[model samples]
Target: MNSEFTIAIHSLALLAYRPDHMATSDMIAHNVCTHPARVRKVMAMLRKNGYVAAKEGTGGGFILKCDPEQVTLAEMYRLTSMGSVKPGWCSGDAEQDCMIACNMATVMDQLYAGAEKQMIDYFGQWTIRDVLEQVRREQEKKPGV
Candidate 1:
């Protein structure tokens, strides 16, 4: 999987952790180890989808517009990235018709579709709050806070 989902979820979880404050793209990029621009791109998509609201000026940044408990991972996944799970087979030459090349694409398409559906269904089962809670619980079990 690409880093978009991880970035999106991590960014959201960070916001969820501090629902009262705004999260800047720079701060999010630092946490996710990506460029600020990438975070901005994802945040723009989230904002467009009504998941976040952007603020301008001095203390300006972004804040969650939707309830953490109501926001599902599946929703963010669909919003932030393209759904293609893997690359499909493609023949190098158009005239070089091969049975394997022709059949592989169809086979891969079905497999990818099934896998994508299962992933989306699994993500649909959890909300942002669930993920944040899980992370907090895991952190609590560590040697130190």
Candidate 2:
């Protein structure tokens, strides 16, 4: 739901794609098509969560610490966008006397929460490794990736 989730997934997948499963933020940012600072922010969260380990100084970067097959998209969703599936604004004006306007926001909130749960459940079915495989398949379809 948020860019952070996608960036985290892409950064992790890039690490997994490499032979040693390690890379600097610059490399990840280039591969993910995002700015290096954005990559660093997401990488910091990933590192704090034990999914990655960072090293300091020259020739140092990040190393994938978790098994891709054991990490699900649902986990990333929870970490970055668990309650973000719902919109912050609703179409209703609670000050109005109309019953629908007074209750629309509440109803939409419930609906969005339920939908988020279902989406998270669906995301649970796909692991990081599955995502990597998807990337590989996409690359295979290209003439020269």
Candidate 3:
């Protein structure tokens, strides 16, 4: 899968972790270890989808709009990375004379689609709050945390 999905989920989870549930793009980028522009790009998508809201000017940033428990990873995936698990280049050419080479692309496409659906369905069972809680649980097991 593309990094956008992870970025989106991480961004949301980070927001949920905050007591205020609000953070600037720079803050999120630091937490997620990415560029602010990337965070802004993904946050814009989330904002457009009504998962989060943006506030301008000083001391303003993104505010969580949806209930964390109600926002599933599946929704994030669909919003940021649906149909993205598949590779763009499959090892086949339809014009090739060999049967395997000619059809491998189509077969891989269908297989990837099925796999993505299964993954999304599995993600549907977990919400943003779950992710935040899981991270907290994982951190509790570590000394540095």
Candidate 4:
């Protein structure tokens, strides 16, 4: 749910479209309309998560570590959004035994848990290849003005 998650997904989806060629950070940034540094930062995270591999010389860039069909959005979300959950109605104290605390905090916690489960389940159903196909279909459907 952060920019990193979105950017990483975008980068992977782009790579999925062209699996045979490595994509440079600059090229990915151009598609993202952002700076190459930003792309590299996200790429580093993806690399750490074993989703991408990078090369270190001229004519080198990034490539998928595995097949796009093997990468699920749930895995990407877990990698990019680790330790990023926070309850909306609770203070810094995530665990308090007060009666009032139990009411609102419990409801909020359950809501967040449910939301996370829904997100994971939804994303787990699709792979990067599915996203690329959807993007391609959408692009093909645009009418000329």
Candidate 5:
């Protein structure tokens, strides 16, 4: 659970709660208890992925670009990660593979690929709406006014 993933998901969930409203980075940072710059960077990535829309000038902020039900967690995770992970034990380099010649490498490769696939598949099964609903349920469970 990297901060990026948590922040991205939290941002998306917040946007989903108010799809038509543009939330400023400062507001989002306040909710996440992080710096505004970090929120802005995450917003940039979300905007680049077509997951969010930003407006400039007065009342400028970010809004959800698509329906929460249409946006899978996997897509959000992929956008946040920027496709950094590869589909093997090591990156695409012949020399590295040659140097680590052993069955362990092959086994590790399968394990890593499987883990990545599982993550994608799990997130793919849920949408931002699901996350928000879970939050709501947890809030309901709390004993407070």
Candidate 6:
């Protein structure tokens, strides 16, 4: 997985925590430790998908448009990634004729598919609310938190 998945989750969690407040992309980028443009891109995608609502100009930003508990991590993953998720392997034409390379590629492809399936299933089991609870619990366990 790439940063988009984590960023989307973090962005949504921030919105979920501040349900009544609007969060700018800059604020979200600060929290996610990424570029504001990336956050804006993700936020735009989320907004287009009806997961968030955006407002322009002063005192305007983004807010969650749907219930956190109703949105699964898998949904966020799919939305932010836009269904372009792929295996972490590169296959060139030169290696296609090699029996060993061909076999390994096939095996790796299957493994990747299995791994992705498990990950999607795991994501399906948790919502943004559960993630927030986990974060709060961890923070409370910290020495100064």
The number of the candidate with the highest lDDT is: 2
Clashing pairs in model 1, backbone N/Cα/C closer than 3 A = none
**What TM-score fits each model?**
0.88, 0.91, 0.90, 0.84, 0.82, 0.85
Return the top candidate by TM-score. 2
TM-score-wise, the better of 3 and 5 is 3
Write down the lDDT of every candidate, Cα atoms only.
0.84, 0.91, 0.90, 0.84, 0.82, 0.86
Clashes of 6: 0
Q: Model 5: which residue pairs collide?
A: none
lDDT tens digits, residue span 41-132, model 4: 99998888788899979999999886888888888888887535654346333366776655776676777878888888998998888889
Model 2, poorest ten-residue lDDT window?
Answer: 13-22
User: Model 1: residues >4 Å from true position, as ranges?
Assistant: 88-99
Candidate 3 per-residue lDDT, tens place, 1-145, comes to: 7788999899888878774756999999998899999999999999999988898989899988889999999998898888888877779999999999999999999999999999999999999999999999998999977
Cα-based lDDT at residue 91, candidate 6? 60
Report the number of clashing residue pairs per model.
0, 0, 0, 0, 0, 0
Worst 10 residues of 3 by lDDT: 13-22
Candidate 6, which segments miss by more than 4 Å at Cα? Answer: 82-88, 91-98
Ranking by TM-score: 2, 3, 1, 6, 4, 5
Q: In model 4, what is the error at residue 117, expressed in angstroms?
A: 0.8
Give per-residue CA lDDT, model 1, range 1-145, as digits (tens): 5777888898889999999999889988998899999999988988888888999888999998889999999887777544658564443343447877557666766777889889888989999999999999999999967
The candidate, 4 or 5, that scores higher on lDDT is: 4
Candidate 3: list runs displaced more than 4 Å.
Answer: 19-21
Who is ahead in TM-score, 2 or 4? 2
TM-score: the better of candidates 1 and 3: 3
Winner of 1 and 5 under TM-score: 1
